[model samples]
Target: MPDSTRQRRPFRREGPDLRRRELIDATLRVIASRGMDAATVRTISEEAGVTPGLIRHYFETKEDLLGAAYDQHMTTLIEMSQQAVEDASQPAVRRLARFVETTLSTPVTDPEALQLWAGFIQRVRRDEAMRRIHRTNYHSFLSCLEELISGALAARGRRPSPDDLKRLTIASNAVVDGLWLEGSALPEMLGPDELTSIALDAIGAILGLDGLNDDLRKELDK
Candidate 1:
């Protein structure tokens, strides 16, 4: 059975500002564990150890709450990916690994995220706000990915065209997203650590790096 079949972690209590944040998080968890249709405000509130009215208080409506939850979920994930690139004090290979590591690891790359993503993907087809949020976050993640791939290409002296870079970005993003779903759903096979390595290796290959071990080799040789 997928590890996701079991509870990943229980939502814990937090401070007031963080309290609402926790509720939003609980929304994702509830949506993940029970599907969006079953993820009622009461259920999310219960998951957060709060009352349903609290959700209405913050969001004023179920649709509003769903939109907020979607935004928070994708934005936080984007911030983590962007952080990995912007905080680069290492070589391009290491920086690229950092991007892969930050993205394909636990917390961000988990069943809960996948479930919430699936739920949101459905909404994106008919929900305007959800579609806009999804597209914005998608571009942001893609842009960062493109930068990392471009850096890898430059490091390996590969002059991929603009179209090539765009295609590479899409492919690499698919690799990461696919690994995320697989690793989250089937931890026995696609565990976080293994997925991280697989993602890094794939990126390196597409960008024409000799292999994904360059960063690790440099560290060990130091």
Candidate 2:
């Protein structure tokens, strides 16, 4: 462990949100490495180098802490796309490509992200807060997707129907989800090159990028 982590192990912050954030991060690190069943308050507190009581101080139950961690991770992931979409330098197509790349590329494509996501997704069926967070991120990224798709299509004077936009957004999100999982599960088997080729081909076909110059195709492939 680094000295910074060593010094911060006690996690004795005065603010509730700050303390909760620390514990939530601890929950992620622990649950990401060990399975969720192993993520007791004792293990998480030990991971945070704080006491189990501290977890209860913020979260009434282990489920609450787990939900908070899931929320934080999803918020982080959504904000990544927000930042990428803020880049005004690229054209709409390239910007869309960058958004897809940011979504499907590493550390987001790492096993830790998928493991944490799988844990949270399983819990969502039972946990109301987790379910809300699930819907929140989906809607949040759906808005971003709508913007990207609308911009890319409108640049060519085509505006999809609201229903079509909704369906396409979900499909695009599913494509990213698949790429993320495949990369995390079989980085060696699929490799980034193969993953990129397959993903670009699929997304391009879906977005109607079937015809373009070699340069633009290479740009999208990038």
Candidate 3:
């Protein structure tokens, strides 16, 4: 355990938004390294080089701070995935491949991220605020993925029903989520690049894009 006294330092006052973000980040770091039980206002204040009173000024309660942290975590994941697929220079197939690859790679595949997610996911079962955050982020992730799938299918001159698109999106999400869980939990089991390749192949098979899979694999080899 860190010495709280030594951890305390002069707090630099900032604008409300920046200070709030810093506190939320501190809360996440504490939760990830020390567990959720240790992320009280005092601990987070120490982590942020501030006082408990300052933390309270930003967050009315500990649960509010926690909810903000979880929301930022989920927002980052969604942003990265969306950015990967939004590269207009890339073909639809390549964009889809990049989305799968990015999701299974760093930032998302980090052990700390997995730890934070695991810790907050349990609270979702009992915390209404956490549950709402989880549901909103989850649906946002799915919506982005579905858009990518539809674009890729259209590029191939194939039009599918809404039901088919939903099914494909769910399956594709499962593939990425499964690989992400395994890679984050057991990094030694597979190399990062290897995990990415496997994800691309699995997603290609799901969407019946074997040719694009070959292109993606070859591109990675370059």
The top-ranked prediction according to lDDT is: 3
Backbone-clash count (model 3): 0
Residues 1-222 of candidate 3 have per-residue lDDT tens digits of 556456567656679999999999999999999998898887888888888898888899999999999999989978987887776777888778778888888888888989999989999999999999999999999998888888889999988899999999999899889888999988888767888888878888889877656766766788
Model 2 clashing residue pairs (backbone): none
List all candidate RMSDs to the true structure. 5.8, 3.9, 1.7
Candidate lDDT values, in order: 0.78, 0.76, 0.86
- Can you give the TM-score per candidate against the true fold? 0.80, 0.86, 0.93
Question: Which regions of candidate 1 fall more than 4 Å away from where they truly are?
Answer: 1-22, 47-54, 220-222
TM-score of candidate 1 versus the correct structure, residues matched by position:
0.80
Give the alpha carbon lDDT tens digit for every residue of 91-197 in model 2.
77767766776676676677788888987788888878889989988888888977887787777687899999788778877877788789988777777656655
Give per-residue lDDT, candidate 2, residue 43: 79
| Superior candidate under lDDT, 1 versus 2 | 1
Residue runs of model 3 more than 4 Å from their true location after superposition: 1-7
